[model samples]
Every structure is written in structure tokens, then in C-alpha cells.
Target: MTFARHCVFDGSSVGSEEWCASLDEKDKGDWSANEAADYAKYCVF
Candidate 1:
């Protein structure tokens, strides 16, 4: 997804338990700032 698209959901890197916890849990390690778009697609899981 592009910056404009992903920005709609969450403009920046989603941390803590503020947004989708499922997506955070999906990542076994640090969620790459570059991988935010991939996480939005649920492909990272």
C-alpha cells in the first residue's frame, strides 16, 4: 500500500496496544517501519 492508503488506517508505525493487537502479535520481532504497508495487507502474518 502507498503512504496515502496506509495513512488512512494508521499514519505512523503502530506500537503499544493502541491499534490492532493481532497485527502486532503477528510479528515475532520488532515491526519494521518499512514493513507497515505489508502488515496492513495481513501478509506479514
Candidate 2:
């Protein structure tokens, strides 16, 4: 969170959607993958 704010201060382009997708791609900092997996499992019921 601190690093993200610094990156924005340093003239990096930042958007909520971009941040969300980047976090999703990394799959380390966020729980996107886990949530998706859970949803998929529930859909099978």
C-alpha cells in the first residue's frame, strides 16, 4: 500500500482497474485467485 502510493507520487500511471488487474495477475498480494476458485467450486453444486 505504501509502495503503491509512492509509485503514484513518482509519476506512475495508476488506475483502480489497473491496480486490481495487476494484483490479480500477480496472485500473491490479493485473494482474487482464491475467491475465483471458491466461486467455481460453489458453481459446481
Candidate 3:
């Protein structure tokens, strides 16, 4: 996903509730912000 794709998602990281909630606060935010595209590529189908 590129910046345009990320913007399409409106900055919200979509994923399993358990997985998202399991992350530490700071780590989660960073992961969501910095690696959202890569994360989605690997984590999602």
C-alpha cells in the first residue's frame, strides 16, 4: 500500500481486534502509523 492507499483507509489500521488490542500502546501506535502498509500486506489476506 502506498500513501494514497493509506489515506483511503483514513489512517485507521484495520485488523483483528485481539491483535490490535494486544499491542502495547506506544508500540501499537507506532506500528500503525509507520508500518501500516507493510503490516497490512503481511498480516492480512
Best by the lDDT measure: 1
Sorted on TM-score, best first, the list reads 3, 2, 1
Ranking by lDDT: 1, 3, 2
Candidate 1 per-residue lDDT over residues 1-45, each given as its tens digit? 687566555634453233456566666466676557655664433
The sequence of per-residue lDDT tens digits that candidate 2 reaches over residues 1-45 is 887677655442333345445545655545567555643454334
Instruction: Write the residue-wise lDDT of candidate 3 on 1-45 in tens digits.
Output: 786575555445445444444443436555655456655654556
Candidate 2 Cα errors over 4 Å, as ranges? 1-15, 29-45
TM-score of each: 0.22, 0.28, 0.28
Native-structure RMSD, model 1: 9.3
lDDT per model vs. reference:
0.54, 0.50, 0.51
Per-residue error at 26 for model 3, in Å? 7.0
Clashes of each: 0, 0, 0
Worst window of 10 by summed lDDT in candidate 1: 11-20
